[model samples]
Target: MAETQKEILVRYLQSAREALLWKLDGLGEYDVRRPITPTGTNLLGLVKHVASVELGYFVSCFGRELPVPLPWLEDDAEINADMWATPDESREDIVGLYHLSWEASGRTFDELELESEGEVPWWRPGQRTVTLQQLLVHMIAETNRHAGHADIVRETIDGAAGLRAGVSNLPDEGFDWPSYVDRVESAARTFRASDG
Candidate 1:
Protein backbone atom coordinates (compact mmCIF):
# COMPACT_ATOMS: atom_id res chain seq x y z
CA MET A 1 0.00 0.00 0.00
CA ALA A 2 1.12 3.53 -0.71
CA GLU A 3 2.20 5.43 2.35
CA THR A 4 -0.04 8.24 3.59
CA GLN A 5 1.18 11.82 3.99
CA LYS A 6 1.57 11.33 7.71
CA GLU A 7 3.65 8.23 7.13
CA ILE A 8 5.88 10.11 4.72
CA LEU A 9 6.40 12.93 7.20
CA VAL A 10 7.06 10.40 9.93
CA ARG A 11 9.66 8.71 7.76
CA TYR A 12 11.59 11.90 7.12
CA LEU A 13 11.36 12.95 10.74
CA GLN A 14 12.58 9.53 11.88
CA SER A 15 15.51 9.66 9.49
CA ALA A 16 16.69 12.98 10.87
CA ARG A 17 16.21 11.73 14.40
CA GLU A 18 18.31 8.65 13.71
CA ALA A 19 21.08 10.69 12.13
CA LEU A 20 21.22 12.98 15.14
CA LEU A 21 21.40 10.01 17.51
CA TRP A 22 24.03 8.32 15.37
CA LYS A 23 26.40 11.19 16.08
CA LEU A 24 26.52 10.10 19.72
CA ASP A 25 27.45 6.53 18.96
CA GLY A 26 30.85 5.17 20.10
CA LEU A 27 31.65 8.40 21.95
CA GLY A 28 32.53 8.75 25.60
CA GLU A 29 30.35 10.57 28.11
CA TYR A 30 32.41 13.74 27.91
CA ASP A 31 32.52 13.81 24.12
CA VAL A 32 28.77 13.37 23.71
CA ARG A 33 27.93 16.17 26.19
CA ARG A 34 30.73 18.70 25.63
CA PRO A 35 29.98 21.83 23.62
CA ILE A 36 31.57 21.89 20.17
CA THR A 37 30.36 25.30 19.06
CA PRO A 38 30.76 28.84 20.47
CA THR A 39 27.04 28.70 21.19
CA GLY A 40 27.52 25.53 23.21
CA THR A 41 25.95 22.97 20.85
CA ASN A 42 26.62 19.39 21.87
CA LEU A 43 25.58 15.98 20.52
CA LEU A 44 23.64 14.62 23.46
CA GLY A 45 22.29 18.06 24.15
CA LEU A 46 20.94 18.15 20.63
CA VAL A 47 19.14 14.93 21.39
CA LYS A 48 17.70 16.41 24.54
CA HIS A 49 16.61 19.62 22.89
CA VAL A 50 14.99 17.87 20.00
CA ALA A 51 13.24 15.41 22.26
CA SER A 52 11.85 18.16 24.42
CA VAL A 53 10.77 20.24 21.46
CA GLU A 54 9.22 17.29 19.70
CA LEU A 55 7.18 16.61 22.79
CA GLY A 56 6.04 20.21 22.84
CA TYR A 57 4.99 20.08 19.20
CA PHE A 58 3.46 16.63 18.97
CA VAL A 59 2.05 16.19 22.46
CA SER A 60 1.57 19.42 24.38
CA CYS A 61 0.67 21.66 21.45
CA PHE A 62 -2.11 19.30 20.47
CA GLY A 63 -3.62 19.21 23.97
CA ARG A 64 -2.20 15.76 24.56
CA GLU A 65 -0.73 15.04 27.93
CA LEU A 66 3.04 14.79 28.10
CA PRO A 67 4.31 11.40 29.14
CA VAL A 68 6.28 13.17 31.83
CA PRO A 69 6.90 16.73 32.90
CA LEU A 70 10.02 18.44 31.58
CA PRO A 71 11.45 20.24 34.57
CA TRP A 72 14.03 22.08 32.51
CA LEU A 73 11.33 23.89 30.57
CA GLU A 74 9.72 25.41 33.64
CA ASP A 75 9.71 29.21 34.02
CA ASP A 76 12.20 29.24 36.87
CA ALA A 77 14.74 27.04 35.13
CA GLU A 78 18.02 28.49 33.98
CA ILE A 79 18.35 29.80 30.45
CA ASN A 80 19.08 27.13 27.84
CA ALA A 81 18.53 24.52 30.49
CA ASP A 82 17.20 22.09 27.92
CA MET A 83 20.28 22.41 25.75
CA TRP A 84 22.70 20.57 28.01
CA ALA A 85 22.74 17.82 30.58
CA THR A 86 23.80 18.31 34.17
CA PRO A 87 26.34 16.06 35.86
CA ASP A 88 23.49 14.31 37.63
CA GLU A 89 21.74 13.57 34.34
CA SER A 90 23.38 10.53 32.85
CA ARG A 91 23.56 9.78 29.15
CA GLU A 92 20.91 7.13 29.63
CA ASP A 93 18.58 9.67 31.15
CA ILE A 94 18.64 11.90 28.09
CA VAL A 95 18.48 9.05 25.59
CA GLY A 96 15.72 7.38 27.55
CA LEU A 97 13.65 10.55 27.54
CA TYR A 98 14.23 10.87 23.81
CA HIS A 99 12.95 7.36 23.25
CA LEU A 100 9.97 7.94 25.46
CA SER A 101 9.17 11.08 23.53
CA TRP A 102 9.30 9.12 20.31
CA GLU A 103 6.69 6.72 21.62
CA ALA A 104 4.47 9.60 22.69
CA SER A 105 4.94 11.34 19.37
CA GLY A 106 4.22 8.15 17.50
CA ARG A 107 0.92 7.94 19.29
CA THR A 108 0.16 11.46 18.17
CA PHE A 109 0.97 10.54 14.62
CA ASP A 110 -1.33 7.57 14.77
CA GLU A 111 -4.27 9.34 16.29
CA LEU A 112 -4.28 12.75 14.65
CA GLU A 113 -5.29 13.61 11.09
CA LEU A 114 -2.96 15.76 9.04
CA GLU A 115 -5.44 18.64 9.00
CA SER A 116 -6.13 18.58 12.72
CA GLU A 117 -5.64 22.04 14.17
CA GLY A 118 -3.78 22.98 17.33
CA GLU A 119 -2.46 26.17 18.82
CA VAL A 120 1.19 26.70 19.66
CA PRO A 121 1.02 28.71 22.84
CA TRP A 122 4.63 29.81 22.57
CA TRP A 123 4.27 31.24 19.09
CA ARG A 124 3.16 34.79 18.33
CA PRO A 125 -0.57 35.41 18.75
CA GLY A 126 -1.34 35.63 15.07
CA GLN A 127 0.66 32.50 14.25
CA ARG A 128 -0.17 30.42 17.26
CA THR A 129 -2.62 28.16 15.48
CA VAL A 130 -1.21 25.30 13.39
CA THR A 131 -2.31 22.07 11.77
CA LEU A 132 -0.70 18.71 12.26
CA GLN A 133 0.67 18.89 8.76
CA GLN A 134 2.38 22.21 9.37
CA LEU A 135 3.91 21.10 12.61
CA LEU A 136 5.15 17.92 10.95
CA VAL A 137 6.95 19.88 8.27
CA HIS A 138 8.23 22.40 10.78
CA MET A 139 9.62 19.64 12.97
CA ILE A 140 11.15 17.80 10.03
CA ALA A 141 13.00 20.97 9.09
CA GLU A 142 13.97 21.69 12.66
CA THR A 143 15.24 18.16 13.29
CA ASN A 144 17.24 18.13 10.09
CA ARG A 145 18.75 21.47 11.02
CA HIS A 146 19.94 20.08 14.33
CA ALA A 147 21.11 16.90 12.63
CA GLY A 148 23.31 19.04 10.39
CA HIS A 149 24.72 20.69 13.50
CA ALA A 150 25.33 17.24 14.95
CA ASP A 151 27.17 16.24 11.78
CA ILE A 152 29.67 19.08 11.99
CA VAL A 153 30.09 18.67 15.74
CA ARG A 154 30.65 14.92 15.36
CA GLU A 155 33.14 15.48 12.56
CA THR A 156 35.08 17.92 14.70
CA ILE A 157 35.09 15.53 17.61
CA ASP A 158 36.72 12.52 15.86
CA GLY A 159 36.73 13.05 12.09
CA ALA A 160 33.56 11.01 11.68
CA ALA A 161 31.09 12.21 9.06
CA GLY A 162 28.20 10.51 7.26
CA LEU A 163 24.46 10.37 6.77
CA ARG A 164 24.34 7.50 9.18
CA ALA A 165 26.21 4.33 10.14
CA GLY A 166 27.24 2.18 7.13
CA VAL A 167 25.95 4.85 4.76
CA SER A 168 28.38 7.71 4.27
CA ASN A 169 26.58 9.25 1.26
CA LEU A 170 29.92 10.90 0.56
CA PRO A 171 32.67 10.35 -2.00
CA ASP A 172 34.02 6.97 -2.90
CA GLU A 173 36.20 4.82 -0.64
CA GLY A 174 39.49 6.14 -2.05
CA PHE A 175 38.54 9.82 -2.24
CA ASP A 176 41.16 12.19 -0.86
CA TRP A 177 39.45 14.67 1.48
CA PRO A 178 42.61 16.63 2.29
CA SER A 179 43.42 17.33 -1.36
CA TYR A 180 39.83 18.23 -2.03
CA VAL A 181 39.83 20.71 0.85
CA ASP A 182 43.11 22.21 -0.35
CA ARG A 183 41.76 22.64 -3.88
CA VAL A 184 38.58 24.26 -2.60
CA GLU A 185 40.63 26.56 -0.38
CA SER A 186 42.87 27.53 -3.31
CA ALA A 187 39.87 28.55 -5.39
CA ALA A 188 38.53 30.76 -2.58
CA ARG A 189 41.99 32.26 -2.02
CA THR A 190 42.03 33.49 -5.65
CA PHE A 191 39.31 36.03 -4.68
CA ARG A 192 41.27 37.32 -1.68
CA ALA A 193 43.01 40.23 -3.51
CA SER A 194 40.03 41.02 -5.78
CA ASP A 195 37.81 42.18 -2.89
CA GLY A 196 38.24 45.94 -2.32
Candidate 2:
Protein backbone atom coordinates (compact mmCIF):
# COMPACT_ATOMS: atom_id res chain seq x y z
CA MET A 1 0.00 0.00 0.00
CA ALA A 2 1.10 3.54 -0.72
CA GLU A 3 2.10 5.53 2.31
CA THR A 4 0.99 9.07 3.00
CA GLN A 5 3.46 11.92 2.75
CA LYS A 6 3.34 12.52 6.49
CA GLU A 7 4.09 8.88 7.20
CA ILE A 8 7.08 8.94 4.89
CA LEU A 9 8.48 12.09 6.46
CA VAL A 10 7.88 10.81 9.97
CA ARG A 11 9.70 7.58 9.21
CA TYR A 12 12.77 9.44 7.93
CA LEU A 13 12.74 11.86 10.85
CA GLN A 14 12.59 8.99 13.32
CA SER A 15 15.39 7.14 11.52
CA ALA A 16 17.69 10.13 11.84
CA ARG A 17 16.76 10.47 15.49
CA GLU A 18 17.52 6.82 16.09
CA ALA A 19 20.88 7.10 14.36
CA LEU A 20 21.88 10.02 16.55
CA LEU A 21 20.80 8.22 19.68
CA TRP A 22 22.51 4.97 18.75
CA LYS A 23 25.91 6.64 18.97
CA LEU A 24 25.48 6.78 22.73
CA ASP A 25 24.81 3.07 23.13
CA GLY A 26 27.20 0.83 25.16
CA LEU A 27 29.06 3.95 26.33
CA GLY A 28 29.48 5.09 29.88
CA GLU A 29 28.04 8.34 31.18
CA TYR A 30 31.46 9.94 31.26
CA ASP A 31 32.19 8.87 27.73
CA VAL A 32 28.87 10.15 26.49
CA ARG A 33 29.37 13.45 28.27
CA ARG A 34 33.02 13.95 27.47
CA PRO A 35 33.81 16.34 24.67
CA ILE A 36 35.15 14.38 21.71
CA THR A 37 35.97 17.36 19.51
CA PRO A 38 37.53 20.78 19.97
CA THR A 39 34.06 22.18 19.40
CA GLY A 40 32.79 20.12 22.37
CA THR A 41 30.41 17.88 20.47
CA ASN A 42 29.44 15.03 22.76
CA LEU A 43 26.91 12.22 22.38
CA LEU A 44 24.59 13.37 25.15
CA GLY A 45 24.81 16.96 24.04
CA LEU A 46 23.86 16.12 20.50
CA VAL A 47 20.70 14.58 21.89
CA LYS A 48 20.09 17.72 23.88
CA HIS A 49 20.66 19.96 20.90
CA VAL A 50 18.29 18.05 18.64
CA ALA A 51 15.62 17.96 21.32
CA SER A 52 15.72 21.74 21.56
CA VAL A 53 15.67 22.11 17.79
CA GLU A 54 12.74 19.73 17.48
CA LEU A 55 10.66 21.64 19.99
CA GLY A 56 11.50 25.00 18.47
CA TYR A 57 10.76 24.03 14.88
CA PHE A 58 7.73 21.84 15.56
CA VAL A 59 5.89 23.27 18.58
CA SER A 60 7.07 26.85 18.94
CA CYS A 61 6.74 27.61 15.25
CA PHE A 62 3.07 26.75 15.32
CA GLY A 63 2.27 29.49 17.85
CA ARG A 64 2.70 26.97 20.62
CA GLU A 65 5.33 26.24 23.26
CA LEU A 66 6.57 23.10 24.94
CA PRO A 67 5.33 23.02 28.53
CA VAL A 68 8.90 22.90 29.76
CA PRO A 69 11.57 25.40 30.61
CA LEU A 70 14.43 25.67 28.17
CA PRO A 71 16.72 28.31 29.60
CA TRP A 72 19.18 27.75 26.79
CA LEU A 73 16.75 29.42 24.44
CA GLU A 74 16.75 32.55 26.58
CA ASP A 75 18.75 35.60 25.55
CA ASP A 76 20.54 35.88 28.89
CA ALA A 77 21.58 32.26 29.11
CA GLU A 78 25.23 31.26 28.81
CA ILE A 79 26.54 30.42 25.40
CA ASN A 80 26.53 26.76 24.24
CA ALA A 81 23.97 25.67 26.80
CA ASP A 82 22.01 23.98 24.10
CA MET A 83 25.13 22.30 22.74
CA TRP A 84 26.33 20.77 26.02
CA ALA A 85 24.70 19.44 29.12
CA THR A 86 25.96 20.73 32.45
CA PRO A 87 27.25 18.50 35.24
CA ASP A 88 23.98 18.93 37.14
CA GLU A 89 22.04 17.57 34.21
CA SER A 90 22.20 13.80 34.16
CA ARG A 91 22.42 11.76 30.97
CA GLU A 92 18.96 10.34 31.54
CA ASP A 93 17.58 13.81 32.15
CA ILE A 94 18.57 15.15 28.77
CA VAL A 95 17.72 11.97 26.91
CA GLY A 96 14.31 11.80 28.54
CA LEU A 97 13.70 15.43 27.73
CA TYR A 98 14.54 14.73 24.13
CA HIS A 99 12.10 11.84 23.95
CA LEU A 100 9.41 13.95 25.58
CA SER A 101 10.06 16.67 23.05
CA TRP A 102 9.63 14.07 20.36
CA GLU A 103 6.24 13.20 21.74
CA ALA A 104 5.16 16.83 21.66
CA SER A 105 6.46 17.27 18.15
CA GLY A 106 4.80 14.08 17.05
CA ARG A 107 1.53 15.38 18.42
CA THR A 108 1.99 18.44 16.27
CA PHE A 109 2.42 16.20 13.28
CA ASP A 110 -0.78 14.40 14.14
CA GLU A 111 -2.87 17.47 14.86
CA LEU A 112 -1.98 19.54 11.83
CA GLU A 113 -2.04 19.01 8.11
CA LEU A 114 1.09 19.41 6.03
CA GLU A 115 -0.02 22.81 4.77
CA SER A 116 -0.83 24.12 8.24
CA GLU A 117 0.47 27.63 8.82
CA GLY A 118 3.36 28.50 11.10
CA GLU A 119 5.78 31.34 11.72
CA VAL A 120 9.51 31.34 12.37
CA PRO A 121 9.95 34.69 14.05
CA TRP A 122 13.72 34.44 14.18
CA TRP A 123 14.02 34.08 10.47
CA ARG A 124 14.60 37.27 8.53
CA PRO A 125 11.55 39.21 7.48
CA GLY A 126 9.63 37.99 4.44
CA GLN A 127 10.62 34.39 5.15
CA ARG A 128 9.20 33.73 8.59
CA THR A 129 6.08 32.02 7.36
CA VAL A 130 6.28 28.27 6.69
CA THR A 131 4.14 25.21 6.24
CA LEU A 132 4.29 22.05 8.29
CA GLN A 133 5.63 20.23 5.26
CA GLN A 134 8.50 22.68 4.87
CA LEU A 135 9.39 22.38 8.54
CA LEU A 136 9.35 18.59 8.26
CA VAL A 137 11.82 18.64 5.38
CA HIS A 138 13.94 21.25 7.14
CA MET A 139 14.20 19.06 10.22
CA ILE A 140 15.07 15.97 8.20
CA ALA A 141 17.94 17.93 6.64
CA GLU A 142 19.08 19.42 9.94
CA THR A 143 18.82 16.19 11.94
CA ASN A 144 20.49 14.03 9.30
CA ARG A 145 23.31 16.54 9.03
CA HIS A 146 23.80 16.32 12.78
CA ALA A 147 23.51 12.52 12.59
CA GLY A 148 26.47 12.56 10.21
CA HIS A 149 28.38 14.59 12.75
CA ALA A 150 27.42 12.07 15.40
CA ASP A 151 28.63 9.27 13.15
CA ILE A 152 32.09 10.76 12.73
CA VAL A 153 32.30 11.64 16.39
CA ARG A 154 31.28 8.11 17.34
CA GLU A 155 33.87 6.66 14.97
CA THR A 156 36.51 8.87 16.53
CA ILE A 157 35.53 7.56 19.93
CA ASP A 158 35.39 3.77 19.37
CA GLY A 159 35.67 2.89 15.66
CA ALA A 160 31.94 2.15 15.46
CA ALA A 161 30.72 3.34 12.08
CA GLY A 162 27.40 2.81 10.25
CA LEU A 163 24.00 4.30 9.62
CA ARG A 164 22.93 2.40 12.71
CA ALA A 165 23.92 -0.63 14.75
CA GLY A 166 23.88 -3.93 12.78
CA VAL A 167 23.58 -1.96 9.57
CA SER A 168 26.83 -1.48 7.67
CA ASN A 169 26.03 1.52 5.53
CA LEU A 170 29.72 1.62 4.60
CA PRO A 171 31.46 -0.41 1.94
CA ASP A 172 33.99 -2.50 3.82
CA GLU A 173 34.16 -5.32 1.22
CA GLY A 174 36.90 -7.05 3.33
CA PHE A 175 39.33 -4.09 3.18
CA ASP A 176 41.25 -3.56 6.44
CA TRP A 177 41.22 -0.16 8.16
CA PRO A 178 45.00 0.38 7.89
CA SER A 179 44.99 -0.49 4.23
CA TYR A 180 42.02 1.78 3.60
CA VAL A 181 43.70 4.64 5.43
CA ASP A 182 46.92 4.13 3.46
CA ARG A 183 45.11 4.21 0.16
CA VAL A 184 43.18 7.31 1.13
CA GLU A 185 46.33 9.08 2.38
CA SER A 186 48.28 8.14 -0.73
CA ALA A 187 45.54 9.57 -2.92
CA ALA A 188 45.61 12.80 -0.96
CA ARG A 189 49.40 13.03 -1.31
CA THR A 190 49.11 12.45 -5.03
CA PHE A 191 46.53 15.18 -5.33
CA ARG A 192 48.79 17.56 -3.40
CA ALA A 193 51.70 16.72 -5.69
CA SER A 194 49.59 17.38 -8.80
CA ASP A 195 48.48 20.75 -7.41
CA GLY A 196 52.00 21.90 -6.74
Report the lDDT tens digits of candidate 1 across residue range 1-196. 9998899999999999999899999999999999989999999889999999999999999999999999999999999999999999999999999999899999999999999999899999999999999999999999999999999999999999999989999998889999999999999999999985
Over the stretch 1-196, how does candidate 2's per-residue lDDT look in tens digits? 9989999999999999999998888888888888989889988888899999899999999988786989998989888889888989998899898899889998999999999989998999999999999999999999999889888888888888888878978886675878889999988997896788
* Model 2, CA-based lDDT: 0.90
TM-scores, each model vs. reference: 0.97, 0.95
Q: Give per-model CA RMSD.
A: 1.1, 1.5
The global C-alpha lDDT for each of the candidates, from Candidate 1 onward, is: 0.94, 0.90
Model 1 ranges with Cα > 4 A deviation: 194-196
lDDT for position 12 in model 1: 95
In candidate 2, stretches whose alpha carbon ends up further than 4 angstroms from where it belongs are 172-174, 193-196
